[model samples]
Target chain A: MAIINYANKEVQFKIVFYGPALCGKTTNLAYIHSQITETNKGELVSLATAADRTLFFDFLPLNAIVIRNFKTKFQLYTVPGQVIYNATRQLVLRSVDAVVFVADSQWDKMEENIESFRNLDENLARQGLSLDTIPYVIQLNKRDMPNVAPIHYLDFILNDRAVCVPSFEASATTGQGVFDTLNTVSRMLLVKFARDAEAAAYVKSQPTPAASPMDGVAAGLRQPQAAR
Target chain B: MQSTPIVTIAAAEKFLKTLEEFLNHSEAFFALIIDRGGTILSQSGRPPDGTDITILAALAAGSFAATRELATRVGESEFNALYQQGSHFHILMNAVDDDTMLVTIFSTQTTVGLVRFYSARTSEQIAIQMQELRADCVDAPLVFTEADLNTASQIFRDTTDKAV
Candidate 1:
């Protein structure tokens, strides 16, 4: 869920980078963390194993942009992509506003990418969400590799949806397309917020019961954020 | 399904101030309001320079999430409260709402019972303010104008330039 805290004049949105194991999800975060100045970014926290595989998730809180006097913050998270970490993946997906589906572009890893995407759908469905509803972007990572599949083929497989969402060709380690992915997702979130606010305004203008100031923190929010 | 809580800077400052005063009066050492994702919404009281609230929030959220899972398996709907008793100080965590939590750290001078009692009340008040802010936000216009978009675009563009 996007946290638009009027009390603090700040808006925070949670963006999760998700993909199969070793698809460069953590690399995406590390690259962005290194690029952001210390003043605008929090310390990057990674819960990983001795071999450096993520055990739980990686978190990096970034605050730089200000929209209409409201400080905009993005809490970027990368779930442990290993198949065994599916439970943790579902946990991390809770309340997510946007997602970056990082797919390994190597031809041999195509199965892993497809399986992960299917798992993503299943996990989201468990939470009553669908890819069709949430604003997301696809990142075809490891594009610089020799064995990578063509962008068009990847798009045909992943982007052939009701709507073909924005997809980026990235080499996360070398920093290619990292910021482009971030920038596009952030803009998409902002646009979505604007549209939702307009709908909320219409609802607010109607004659409804005077809502209990304290009620519906979860129930009322479920409507706007969960709407497809 | 609800919109994110929209907190004005002044309101946030005011709430922090109020929380600071409350902590002092309650004899607590620190207070932190964290969102469900474990992001520090606001914090009060003196913290050591090395205190990383981000990690703390993330861990706390993770702990709560794990504990809640345990609760469900044990036939409980959810665990709304958590307490950890340390050697010198005690910690208390109370759910402010479905998506928010209040964490209090205090010395042994203040008993857990007192902290719990006070924190419960404080959480209620905070929830009211937060929900009201959310309610008021419906009328709050999106003032993100063309200039703001350009500025944002330029800011990201600068970052993109660096990354490239």
Candidate 2:
């Protein structure tokens, strides 16, 4: 979660762009980087290794002003594709405030979509979090393909108690529903954050304790010059 | 279910602001909360920046369970605290009332007194927050994903080695 401080107010949230590999996850980000007004997004840092693979991750920061009083900020990220990157994928699912599960929607990719969706559920369980509890969305990418699955079919598969995660169909390559999907997720994020605010307010009036982190944890955050 | 105690935004802000201040003065990484069962509630610090905390929380839970097993072998029910001092810094986890944990990251640059001073205060603050959450937890059942941790230890170890 990226924390933002504005006029003495702060909001911290996380946005995850989850999808099957090469469903234009990176392309969606590239488009956002090029189109957004500078004040919105942060530096798109991609930590790649010698072979040019996403060794660590890529980060995109964006802000929203929905409530008249509170300002919200989101840290958007894409888990490295490829099944072998499972460890990295697990790590990216932490403290996610909201999720956009982008699906590869060409007709032949049905199995991949289902697998990716299942993988998302699996990872959430590891963190003791579930789609049923957290706010999430579904995005159908590569929608322009000739053999893309019907929207109804894809929707039926994803529907659940946490069912029917809000979804959008877009050709991320052509900059279709990308922004609209983002906007939908961002709005949902604000709604959830507001709930937290309400809970926080109620807790404070009672002189209650807060869940705290270990000492030296935050204070000791450094870039670590290559981990000597 | 009724909620735990409430954790107001004002309270969290004050606590986090203090936390940010502490982070500004120190160079620690990876401090988070662990349950009696080792589930993580929240985390602060810089190490898991790119990595996901949800995943780390589960791993920490696993590590905590491992710690309990190790403690039991020595005739103890649980391990109150655990620390691993790498070449450059410290990874510390302190047990609080069996129901919660206070994990911290430290460096030799700061004196032990400073670490103690901050932790004692922060622990109380976190304890308060936990109580609030407990009062109103919406207790949702979660399914664990075995595949995510499927990396044969060597693969994970290799990645850390490569990163370091």
User: How closely does chain A match the true chain A in each prediction, as TM-score?
Assistant: 0.89, 0.80
Cα RMSD for candidates in order = 7.7, 17.1
Give lDDT tens digits, candidate 2, residues A1-228. 223233235455677787776676777776666666676656675655776566445566655442344444566777776667666677666556688888888777778778888998899888777888778888888878888888888888765543566788887777777777777776666555555555645566576566468545755675365755
Candidate 1: where are CA atoms >4 Å away? A202-228, B1-4, B8-22, B85-90, B128-136, B143-151, B155-164
Cα misplacement distance, residue A153 of candidate 1 (Å): 1.9
Winning candidate number (DockQ): 1
- lDDT tens digits, residue span A102-192, model 1: 9999999999999999999898888778999888999999999999999999998888899999999999998998888988888888778
lDDT against the true structure, each candidate? 0.82, 0.61
lDDT of 2 by residue, B12-94 (tens): 45546645655555445546655433233445567643554544444454455567667888999987667666766666666
| Model 1 chain A lDDT-worst window of ten | A218-227
